[model samples]
Target: MRNRMFAVVALACILVGCGGCSTQGVARQFADELGEVALSAPPTGATYYLQVDNARVIEDAAGDVDMPYCYDLPAWSEDGAETSVVFRTARKLRDGAYLRFDAALLRGMISWEEVGYDELPDAVREVM
Candidate 1:
């Protein structure tokens, strides 16, 4: 009985440890889903945004630049069709301002481009 209980506990522990349901895991899964949708030919288009709300901002693991946190999710058309994959950063900038990005350059296909701060959205500016 003792051996059986130990085995059961060990198995449970292993299963719990193996469960990949952490926030980071969820984010990675989301990124993966976006990648799949991006690869597929969507009719309207797909936008992938990594959002960090409020004062908390996720730093780019590859570099020192802060992530373009946004309140919106990556926009993709419901109907699968060929369209542009636009990447944007809507993050709060220094001095009570926000840095934004444009949809001119299609990104997130092969790599992400570093865009300069454009301007804060009207609503965001108003709030600040």
Candidate 2:
């Protein structure tokens, strides 16, 4: 009878331990999935406004491929934050064209798209 009780208790303990491990594994899986979703989502970073100017055409070309045009322009945020951004484009941007820039601290400029003058914030419009 004693041996039987000991065996039952040991089995219960083992099962309890396994249950804890299973819970931990589930939590870990959830965390991993959340991290992946965060990484895959688009960057929610600062947006800056600027106007396209003359591009510094890249002279080096590989084979017959068209060289990229580089632009180093001053950018401003809605709150009047100022910064300089340098980026390359496959083709030249129209001079005096306004653009919205998505930027991250570590990644610099993430992307840019042309926007109408009216779309710019009042602070950005005032300066430009």
Candidate 3:
């Protein structure tokens, strides 16, 4: 019984330590998700201001930037259509940069499965 319990506990730890759900780890998370993103590691020292806008990618002077930065589905997006939304950041990030989202501000928005550099859902602004 003890051996079995130890095995389970070890497995759980392994899973949690290896990036389960929370997208916190700066370098590893960015590497898996946005490899083509041109940015440095996310800003470490300064607290950032975040609110959901149409599409805005914030940049830092010390060589960090963040996100494919998408928001606000197009008017034509709908239930069963392929929708692509694009937004441009004011500045570009250097290599190894990353964008971080405001978890608190993004409340009720950003589905777990839908978070990616992919097509936006066609749901209307009200629906989003």
Question: Which lDDT values do the candidates have, in the order given?
Answer: 0.38, 0.67, 0.32
lDDT of 2 by residue, 81-101 (tens): 666666666777888999997
**In model 1, how large is the Cα lDDT of residue 3?**
100
TM-score of each: 0.23, 0.58, 0.21
Instruction: After the best TM-score superposition of candidate 3, give how far the Cα of residue 125 lies from its true spot, in angstroms.
Output: 8.4
**lDDT for model 3:** 0.32
Best by lDDT: 2
The residue pairs in collision within model 2 are none
- C-alpha RMSD of each candidate structure in angstroms: 12.6, 13.2, 14.1
Worst 10 residues of 1 by lDDT: 98-107
Q: Which candidate would rank higher by lDDT, 1 or 3?
A: 1
Runs of candidate 2 with Cα error greater than 4 angstroms are 1-44, 55-67
Q: Which regions in candidate 3 have their CA more than 4 angstroms from the true location? A: 20-128
- What C-alpha lDDT, on a 0 to 100 scale, does residue 64 get in candidate 1? 28
Q: Rank the candidates by TM-score, best first.
A: 2, 1, 3
Model 3 misses residue 32 by how many Å?
12
